[model samples]
Target chain A: MVIKRKVAVVGAGMTLFRRRMLETGKELCFEAASMALESAGISMRDVDAVVLGSAPDAFDGVHMKGEYLLDGAGGVGKPYTRVFVGGGTGVFAPIAGWWHVASGLFDTCLVVCEEKMSSLHPHPQYAFWGIFDHTLERPLGVNLLWIFALEMRRYMHVYGISEEEIAHVAVKNKRNALDHPCAQLAAKITVEDVMRSEPIVWPIKRLDSSPPSDGAAAVVLASEDTARRICKEPVWIDGVGWSIDSAYWTDRELAYPAYLAEAARMAYRMAGIEEPRREIDVAEVYDPFSYKELHHLEGLGLADKGKAAEMTVAGVTARDGDMPVNPSGGLLGVGNPIAAAGMMKVCEVFWQLSGNAGKRQVKKDVRTGLAQAWGDLMQFSSVIIMRS
Target chain B: MKEGVVKKGQDIGVGRGIEPNPVGSKYAGIEVKESDLRDGRYMSIRYSAMFRYRWDTGIAVGRFLEGLRDGRIVGSRCNVCKRILVPPRVFCELDFAQIDDWVYVYDTGRVNTYSISYIDKQARRMSSPVIVAVVELDGASQGMGIMHLLGEVRPEDVYVGMRVKAVWRSREERKGAITDIVYFKPL
Candidate 1:
């Protein structure tokens, strides 16, 4: 494994995830970026470069959304780049920032990820209609729910899992969110309540879904030299890896996330982590749907296949339990603002590793943690490993 | 299609039942100084995109639409997978192979699942709850359901595995859109 220069997360910031924000996308980016800079005790003038990530321009009804969010993110005249991989964009944004510092091209970099799904008309999910092949798939008038439902069905079939078993994830994540300050749907509920709730698609209920939200998150990354000199308890970026599979989502097995496994393996290998379940203290896996968290848990090697859901029910993933996952309440509990959702996970990992997660802190001494985001028809996966 | 205009005149001595357009519409505009505008402040660069769709699933979808236009329902079968896909696809998902053959299916199915959406996408309040459901078409693969509107069942009555069938609009009101099937009702 090639060892790159060390980089550290000096600070992080995020706007409240919500259904609507009167602030435009650029304004939200500015708010988050400014807060991140303040937290880092630095100014935009000190930043050497900037990296921005946003999921889709379609959701904002603005093409080249990165460019639109540039100035607000302090990318006006600096060496800046916009990187995107759907919902994976947010986590990937920090990875890109890490590379900027790790490559020794810059000593400090500002990373920003933002999404405004509320701006899309009809429904933001309607934007997903075009995510399909315009020639082949769009003709069917397929909605986004179909793909998720089909994946959920296949996951259930292959894992010998029942809908009731999956409902426990909704119960756990929502209950966990009760302590999250930025959570949108934080509540205490039961598996019985999830099963009794109205289903949007078979095996996928309204409660199982992440709400459309408008939010932004920003993180400031710096070289080891700059980090040590300027800040205390800088969370080091131990390893970063991202991968994208073929866009032909239907051809792949929906029951398993091969891309995520590949991405996690690459990051873990670089981080020299031989056994993830034992070494990693906490995790912030993406969970846009309740089943996805369990699915990703398996893919990240935290648990064996067909075992994540069971482990979840056994309370192994609770904030106070071993191998705590999504202690930040996750996308299922906190609202999912797409790009921002991934960065929110990264921010949570930073807070947890820095001993800043006040109420939702995990029980273990979190010396190392991992955050992963998957998106783009389940084809893109990004992983980041951070250590104190 | 037919197009025309209708005109109605007032009865005796009411001067054509017409009134002048209402006035007093208020409009306000403000201008700010360049200095007050926050010079060098952040301003987003704008961009736009337009996409044209030439979908070929039209052949199978056309048949499905025609079925709705005629008060029937249809789907397509994947010969390789042997699974009938409603709102059918042109290719088989499992094999990633072409699916050229189309199969007609009965409208009768079951409400495999459903949700009562209190608010629309815009967060607007609806006068009545909208029942969005997944209806597993007859002869389709197990657990396979096409999303559609549901009616004639209270929110509490709608449950998984409840049998239902499509309710089409009047023939004269038929359109190629999914809305052509007004809603689904208990079988």
Candidate 2:
């Protein structure tokens, strides 16, 4: 892939993840976008274009959430675009901003992702019912937990992986979140706690999942010239890749995420990374569920198939380990605001690369890192590789 | 004296200026308690979608539904792949070719995977849990499964490969839908 102009992330900012925020989605976007602009030492007047990402309008009870959030994202008169790929929208937003800068069409772009899950009635999980097949699956009175529980069960059944092994991911990530100011469920809990928690669905204890949250995150992307001129330590976007699998998720093997592997391979190839495990310093793989972190790690080629749990048990994925994963605690601890959660991963990688992550910084001097997010009926994945 | 003091534009909109919000202390959002929403401390408007519409099940699933009404499970086969798809499709996803034939699959199938859901569709905790499973029917292609409920088996007794047969509802209660069969019970 020949490049027109290199794109780099100059600044990143995010709001604290919470269960119920009085602020509207537009307000959340404004807070995040303003902080990002301030961190970049630039004003909204300097922004050439804007890219916004938010998950389902059903959650916000507002249709056309992107257009509703445009002004808050500093997109009043500039070229604006809204990109949503389910939960992958957060990372996909930056990938869109990368396009505007890398195409030489815009010198500076502001990327913002926001989600207000609290506005939905009954419960946020209720909104997911619309995602299923109304005829084939909905008639079964399906709940979202059924799919994740089934997937987690299949992954365990296939690899002979025990629920105890998966519980360690939640324990590790929650403990790691203690230093995060924006963390929602950060804690120091044992695997026994996870095992003893109420079973929302068999094989899926309450503690094994991230809580629904309301938050927003933003990052500023600039061209090579703009990055060098304005910021001292801009994180260059080394590679970006996204892919979607067949929509019929039930027909595919639940134990492995083939779509994520295809996306990771595309990114690794573009970044010229032959050995992901050895070359990449850290990763913030999506972990909406504890098993998902392991699932995604295997899919990203950071660990061998079905061996991620074993690696986690061996202290290989700890913040102090050789390859730290989710050093910012991840969605499991920070919270899952859908689109914002994915964007938070990208912001974490940017912060980690710039050495701006204060107490959440890993032990190693990381030069290169990767951030990945999965969404859309267990079918879509977006990957971004960055280097300081 | 108070009536004679007519000073215009002297403190008009003075204190409504924007206050600088420090990143660490006072962030942008306000956290409201759930009770606040209930007590009407914050104004909220209720809106419900009136999306009443019919969805065309199309030829493949349309025929499949008709077959279910007649006490038979129908599937379409792509001769290129030589596999019958349950919840049949008109076009082969992999082969990208038109289906060659439609076949009748068995009412009995093995459980591919199952979940004991403690919550209902509205995310409300249920008094009795529902046992949902992906049953890979016999006479269908390998790994092709349909999601349905399980009955006549203890949740603790359910296993991954348990063979189960559909327990059809009464003929008078039968609707040309996937729910025509009440639930799958242990064979």
Candidate 3:
């Protein structure tokens, strides 16, 4: 057994997700970090270390963004480090913070994730070009949507699923976002509405996508002793796991997230969870694209392979449903700020486990929750399990 | 590595072919002057870049953009979810789905949520404060709304659920952007 110290999340905070934000990346970081500290009823002086996570430096048009954001994140002159694995950076930030406390190196840590995708000119999707190989892949002039469309096509083919079925995830999530204060694109629509919507790429319509957004989220982590002394009802970090797959995306099957499954297995083993569907009360799966939610649900072991879409169609994943996924409306409805979007999922899990979710509360008593974020050309996965 | 040399006036000529001396200038005494040039050091530089992508709004979003230019709001309905989506999209989000039903929405909507921006991305002060808001259409669901600018209301007066109406720019001034609709005013 790895003799890791107990870790708890004592505070959480976030800025509203939007397509464009007047606040620069640093300002957003400072605002969110300050709020997290305040929510814990502690000051920035109480934080012993800092871990910063931001998706692509291209999104902000800044190089070595970690160092540039240091002052705003309150990491200046402290034991600060930056870690990123594309979209997974959000949840990974807190997990990194967990290690700082779990290793008994720091009593408290401030974890922050920020992304300003709106700053990228001619559309932020252009920034994704660098995610490919400079020599071999860049010459192809591939857009990020091409890959997602190809994967979506593969998923539909393997599962015999229709585009209409996957559209329900968008409908449900956007509807659920009705109660979310920070939602960017929340709406109530039907299957016919989705089917009739304009197509961006074949199979991926305008409605199936998450918008380019600007936002930041932050959380405070502490050791068991520090948690007990500083806050009430601390959410325990029972397990944390992350994994990366090969960069050669074409070499792997696009129909499933094998990396996510492995990452979830590692987390489950550490958290002592055998039957995730039964043990976990709520979930926040990354849904940059609507199909990703179902894809991730299967990866997280919450539903069997090729069955997540069916469960979603059956209303089992709604806020009042048995599983209650994306209670914060998820990245689909709530807006995806990349790194910040993943942290939003973590924050939703924290809120649900603590019964702090006001209007969006699920209909069951929750004790355990799971949150996962995926990114990097579909190569990385990060999982975190929390318990009250 | 292989070593090779050229002999003056033999394999290679120094000047004026065979007519001139291979070694042109000669000094009476050779004085070696060495200066301390070791103080400078070489530095390596690094560069990074991001890719760019072009997105097409498709027919539905194209129509929606046209509507914005025409001073109208539009939404599409999903047969499966049975909800209206503003800024009409061609597919649903939940099930990897598609939507074909389109509906024109009324300009009347209520403020769902809003924020007052005091600065731009450059951290530059604005001549006037800008109020950005999400407005839920009258018949739309609770969360359904279009994000746009709010005008004619003081920052202090803007509140959640405040009923408002869209104010469009002149036909000549419209540019098919969100800014085409100057702002929303309290109804």
Task: For residues B1-187, write the lDDT of model 2, one tens digit per residue.
Answer: 1233456865433122223444565346666678877877665677777678698999998999888889999999998989889889899988999985999999999988888899987888999999988899999988888889999999999988899999987777778889998899999
Misplaced by over 4 Å in model 3 are B1-187
Best by TM-score: 2
Worst 10 residues of 2 chain A by lDDT: A245-254
Clash number for each model: 0, 0, 52
In order, the interface RMSDs are 10.4, 1.2, 23.7
Ranking under DockQ, best-scoring first?
2, 1, 3
Model 2, C-alpha of A265: deviation from truth (Å)? 0.4
Hey, what RMSD does candidate 2 come out at?
3.2
Ten contiguous residues minimizing lDDT sum, candidate 1 chain A = A133-142
TM-score of chain A of each: 0.98, 0.99, 0.98
Q: What's the best-to-worst order under TM-score?
A: 2, 1, 3
lDDT of candidate model 1 versus the reference: 0.80
What level of docking quality does candidate 2 show? Answer: medium
Q: How far does residue A101 in candidate 2 sit from its true spot (Å)?
A: 1.8
Instruction: Specify the CAPRI tier of model 1.
Output: incorrect
Question: For model 3, what is the alpha-carbon lDDT of residue A306?
Answer: 91
